[model samples]
Target: MMFDAWLTFAVIAGAVYLFVTEKLPIEVVALLVLASLLALRLVSTEEALSGFSSPATITVAAMFVLSAGLQRGGSLYRLGELLAQIRRGWLLALAMMLLTALVSGFINNTAAVAVFLPLVIAATVANRQPPSKYLIALSYAGQFGGVCTLIGTSTNLLVDSLARQSGEAGFTLFEFAPMGVIFVAVGVAYMMVARRFLLPDLGIPEQSDTGHAGRYVVELLVGEKSPAIGRRGSELLPDDAGDVVMLEIFRAKQPVSSPRGEQVQAGDRLLMRGEWRDIEQARKKLRLDYDHVARDLDGDVAAERLHAEAMVAPGSHLIGHTLAEVRFGHTYRVRVQGLHRHRLAIRQPLDRVPLAVGDVLLLDAPEKSLAAMRSDPGLLVLGERVQERTKLGRALLAIGVMTGVVTVAALGWLPIVAAAIFGCIALVMLNVLKTEDAYRAIDWRVIMLLAGVLPMGIALQNSGAAAWIAGIAVDLVGGYGPVVALLTIYLLTTILTEVMSNNASAALVVPIAIATAETLGLDSKPFLVAVAFAASTSFLTPIGYQTNTMVYTAGGYRFTDFVKVGLPLNAIFLVMAGLLIPRYFPFS
Candidate 1:
């Protein structure tokens, strides 16, 4: 191998490591890949920058807006409301899966799940069932539906774009439908049987009679006689108490840099967190003075301070930063009392707890603050819009535009990019969505990720590295026949997708899949299909898919829950791909 090839491999290994550890955000990792290649002069600047202009990138941004339009205009929410009428548990689960899968085939999977999530939880609680029984199924169904169409996921379009760049006629809108439908059929049925045996009843979350459902973040003033003065912050709350944590100590009105290690002062203002009842107990036991926020809650029988549950919205800026870093209480004027992450309920020291999508926060927010939080676009305060009459005209228009977008692209009236872009324009012009809402609807992180990672594929091809790796793969498995090659590629893509970004896995593997096909003197379509399908089927863990992450906290599922349920499903997919992909698109 040439030095450049070796260098590219090194870059690839570094990228894979960073992506798996998530030591940095995905877009940051992607830009690093681009910068490494540029600094090494691996590809021309044009080729490196080409991803920003890629059809896949533009189409994906447009799809985000379109999906947001559907959600905003109430096309999805109105449909979701009907599930509330379901009388049986099995029927409710089945309907949630079917509807989410069907909707996901056209829109972004994350958006589909986000719209239906509260509804799923509500219906389950109403029926006295654990949300655990149905939430993972909802996440999986979104994946099932995503594979059914070209526009369903950015990954599908990305693979198509990569294939087109490789000099092949790319896939059409429904080219993926036959296989996707098969995945949906196998998945929905498998979850139906497996959930009963494999999923545990995590139970419904409890709410406080005070209307605050979680822990409280409050500021306490140190009294002259308080024993807490001169005590270290860590000692403020004993480990066994599990009730209160001193997040920060304001010494003489200025925050000490390290709250825990810093000793408290006589006049320090301490920011503490725990359940309301527990916090009250601590304040009394410690002889502390309560701040006005506390007194407001203490004396207000009128309930002017509203308790609402807010979820970190998908694509929210709050994903990685801790609450203290965001100055959450000060910025939003809400006191967070409780937080649920994955399957664990965090009760104290919330300043260090970073937020992620689907993390539900129990908040004691002023009525005015609740309005600001609702309109912030980064938080989904449940029950805020439950009764807003669905916009009949705008809903129909949004539905019509989305349908037209899918139909035109399917009919070859325009490329998927043109159709999606025009559809976004139509929605804004028709007032189904506001212009600013249309722009806000797009997850720019994904756009930047696509723009940055697409060039890594270019680097692989241009550096002769993809061919070098493809030769090695062909040498190891080529003699075993093309079926073996197909399975090998599928497994490799699946494993990578489980740990890293799906689109990144596709961007990296598609070039190799194409290279392997050319080396073996076979058609690459089936290989590309294997990449597309494998990349989309990320069922092995909570963090692999955004929808999975959302449901992780909402469902109260442990890591092994996904493994217990998704393991058999993954095997079924491997078998399905091995048996069916060849039949659908043969190696000639």
Candidate 2:
């Protein structure tokens, strides 16, 4: 039975690695584990599915909806605006990071990151700095700040719930505050000092003549008389387009990649990436007439659409509505040539999909629509026009609702799950987020990943895999006593986080941490803290945390970028956590 437990543990570890490395979607990996456990008779079907019903899962799902509301209400954008106004150079950046970290200590870190990313990007751009410099800092700050409060991240909640299940006193929302505050301060200081030395001086110009380069809706257009007309697009633009990158091309209203070598037609639109001058020069040199008829191409001519990009505004009656519902072409007199959300291409049909906050809507509409959009109170026309209005009332309302939920949960007036759900409902009722758009805001991928990986955590404990691992842990650190054992657990959990989802890492390590505490006959709080802190501090690899991935492409950073900065930060936190955790919850 013990050997079987060891074997099961090995399987779980392998599955976790495969999932973290994205070899398979996390849900598929989780399902695979469920199937294997049942096949081995380690758990019944009911047991395998138990994780789906856990309060942690429900709370996380509800939180996603609540986050969606905050985003839709423009609360995040407002916050970004404030952060952008800070005038002090690196000091201001440090202050923003500290505030971000402090806020993340109470909310979901990923949600926190999502809320702040756009703002951070805007702030960096405003300061004439490379976004790559500050974006990673914000991500790291959020992860570190989450370690400060149990409610800050799903990983902390998982550890707390698992500890309760193991007959230990679960942590309170603020229980980790003391050590967390210290760690946050230290981490922020380190970032402030390192910003000058470690970060590359991209010397980003103060004003990008590209003028809000993000909103350009530039596409490719192949001419009938061109040398490359009938040839496959792939042949015309090899996988690599050399200097000029083709974003997309339209043939008969259908998008075809240059990689596919699809033959180009007379009126095919080609979406290309180049500076304004370069694009203009290319147009002249190629002798290709511009498709001024394309709404996206010709829209906002007054502002000179340097790069073809578009923007979406809140409260435009477009919120909570899909492109299909808007009859985009007929009603808005615009056709969505392409969509970019979070810097990724959206290949799906625009009509069937609902828009989320931060989504960049690419429209082939008359240039006048840009001015009209700018006039709408709920809309913001990026690049061409900057319209600022006081949405303070709406922003405050969102903050109040979110605060109420946290207060209610803390006072035990309602369960955390109920509180979060109610908060989401209130936001929708207040029109902060439309009821129809609520579901679209929730990231189903993350929810599914959490639900699927949870059962594996349960299987580890039920099958005695946790105990088997704990026993090995005990012997390995036996000479050093409980303190050493605790350190080992923290180190192991930290390593796991670098290779897997933080939530998944927490779930996997909590059981073993508790089991080890039991074996040592010491208080479990220290071990639990170790697991929670370790799980949230996955800075070593971009794959370890979603925020890291969010900045990866945007920053043009390689994997080593994370390693170069994050590895040292990882070690710093590990030492700080190891020393502080035991002091708060001594191993007597």
Candidate 3:
């Protein structure tokens, strides 16, 4: 028993290290923990593989699909339209945080944050305030609301699932809200108070979007004697016409979206937009025989109508591919005009820069093609999603289905797992999310991580490691009181969460929390509650939460920015949890 206990301790420590280092995919590390626990004979094979079929894992996956359906329904986007009307930057910022928290409590917080990301950016641009001021607050708001409901965040469900496995009654949907609301209130108030002094205004400027006042559309034919015939389309604009945008090329009356990798040929008419002087200068620079069929040419002003923006979807196949390599123009039927990464506008050739998940591309495609762009999962077009009458109807239905799922589960008409599963089937039949989109909506990495880590909790308990650790923790803190023991659990969970995946942190700490409660002769619910709140509220670092990581580059924030902004929020959460956790979930 002692050997097994020590071995369990070693495996868990190694797993924690791997999670912190992130040298392997988090899911892979989870699988390793399961494998090690079993191979070391710490857990039976059934126990080792049980997380895959665990209720927590399945519900997490189902919630992901449910969240996708609601997101597709355009409800959040509609809400954003209302928020946009608040012109005062500070209030607008506060409102954004509030809405994010509210929406997140019902669905996946990451999805909630994602839906609001572009809206926040647009609102900031309109108000002429830096997005960085509210982006972190927006991320923190997701956590705030996430803890309010059972289904709000996967971490909540995960801890609930673990608690249920220990023979405790499953938590109701709103069980966490009493304390969660306190946390949100405190966090939001902190944001409002600290906004001016702490929130950094270092967002990346749109350097690619220079002056537009003097530019006009013009078409130039690559004449037979033109030096541009054999070169790439981008090279056609000489230094004098550097601001000119090559929108398209027509050869034999066929349109190409800027000849990405193809050589320009004579008689290929280049569709471009720039200042008339630059246009006239480009015409002279091109050496085209303008006295012939092209002499009576007059330019049209149409480029602005064709330009749009799209972001590379997270986990997109296009993340590492350059524009030329992906044949981006041909594949997506859109011309790549420029790219923004993190906060820096790439002034280099677009052909060489590799795409990343958050990369925002300035594209020139026809209106019809822009509509088609939304169909590809690899890219998310940034702006207000279409609210066409048909889409709005589907969105409404999607909203209804999601509400039913939450209602039935909350009222005990069905287990959350069952209600959620039925809700997903209804969503498909109702066509809110297409079959493929439903699959895409599930962040399988998280599902796999849950499946992979729950078993570690099982192993920890089976090997007597939990009791040993719990005894030590209680011995150190028990002299103070049960409240102090609760605080110890909360603080340790909080520390682990700041360094590793929150789900994993919750999984590892829950069994220890149960053991600690037993050692102290108290109810485990408060300890469990401490674990849930602590694991979910990671604000100390960008990597501590996925939402924070998403907005890191977009907001153009520094590493210390998270520390500077998140420290106070973390303090607020700690204080709130310490006071209210025992109050709501008494330590009897």
Candidate 4:
């Protein structure tokens, strides 16, 4: 039986690695784990499914809906707009980093990062700075800042809930505030200092050179039989595309990626980057005559556009709609170029394929259209954009309801589960969030991931595997005493988070952290705190946190970008937490 439990543990760890590495779609990985557990009889099907209803899961879902309400209300956007006007270089970066860290302390870090990315880019551009410098800082700041509060990130919430289940007093919003604030302050100071010396001034040379706008250069040809053969360049291009500024037109000569709009002729070639697919489709439909001779002309023009990516929310209006039905071009003035169904590639024509929540869509549209599409309840824009504001009264009311629910639960007036459900209902009734929006905000991938992984945690606890692991942990640092043991838990969780999803890492490590604390007969609060902070502070790799991944592609950062900035910050936090945990909650 013990061997069986260990085998279950091995299976789960391997599965989590594969899932986080994205070798398989997260939902599929989850479903497979659930099936395997049931087949092996390690846990009953009911036990495996119970995590779906767990309080932690409910709270996470409710928080997501609450984030939507806040986003819809436009409060986040307003905050972002204020940040964009700051012009001092290092001072501006510090302000943005501090604000991001503060905001992330109270909301999902991923949402926090998404909301601030555009603001950071705009601010950098306004200050005549390269966006790449600020983007990396913003991503790391959000992840680290979330450590300041229990509601700051999902990892904190998960750890708190697990502590409660272990019969310990769970953390309050402010419980972690002291350490979090200090860490963020130190981090802000570090960034302010580093920005001056370490970062390069790679901003585009001219006002016209706005690389921060995220446009790609590409080439398009006018086929001889196309409808646009005789049309003027300005007339053939849509108003949005025309505004992008064509750099040049190549005719029986070398290629041009940017052609002057007025210079185009029937046999002319366009060298452009802004919304190329829309241009190509327009050219093909119009039957113009030319060849894609821009030496830089790349494969799949649609994929080259920066604005072409989207993720399906859990309960979006788009869930059942096909691209054709939505008249993606006619309605939104955008093209659905690629679809990721359940995180796997969907090779079929997007027009004929039905959409589902969690499916990622690659779209091609002008920048303005792309911005509008992001705020649309039917689609979750994957690219970074400025946050938008909605009805404030509604947003406040929803926040008030959540506050009340948390208050009630803390007071023992209601169970956390009941309070969460009540909060969900209150948001809907107040019209702060629509029923569909609320449902879509829930990340079923996370819910399923948690559900599938919980049983394995249980198996670890049920079998002697946890004890064996704990014993090894104890021996490795036994001479160093309980403080070392606490540090070990924190370091282990931190390391795991760099390679896996923070939530998944927490689920795997919390059980071990708890068991280790028990073996030492010490207060588990410090150990739990370590796990919470470590899981939320995954900065070394983009794969560690969703916020990191969100900024990775948008910032055009390579993998080493994360390592360069994050590794040092991770070390700083690890040391700070190790020192502080012992001081705050000493072991007997």
Top lDDT prediction, candidate number: 1
Report lDDT per candidate.
Answer: 0.83, 0.67, 0.78, 0.68
Worst 10 residues of 4 by lDDT: 205-214
Best by TM-score: 1
**Of candidates 2 and 1, the better by lDDT:** 1
Segments in model 2 whose C-alpha atoms lie over 4 Å from true places: 205-221, 227-390, 428-432
For each of the candidates, the C-alpha root-mean-square deviation to the true structure, in angstroms, is: 3.8, 5.9, 8.4, 8.9
The per-residue C-alpha lDDT of model 4 at residue 114 equals 71
lDDT string for model 4 (204-278, tens) is 323233233233334455565656555555566655443343445567655444343454555665554343345
Candidates in order, TM-scores: namely: 0.88, 0.78, 0.79, 0.76
- Candidate 2 lDDT trough over 10 residues, lowest sum: 208-217
How far residue 260's Cα lies from its native spot in candidate 1, in Å, is 9.0
Name the lDDT of candidate 1: 0.83
* Candidate order (TM-score): 1, 3, 2, 4
Off by over 4 Å in 3: 203-330, 334-371, 374-378, 381-390
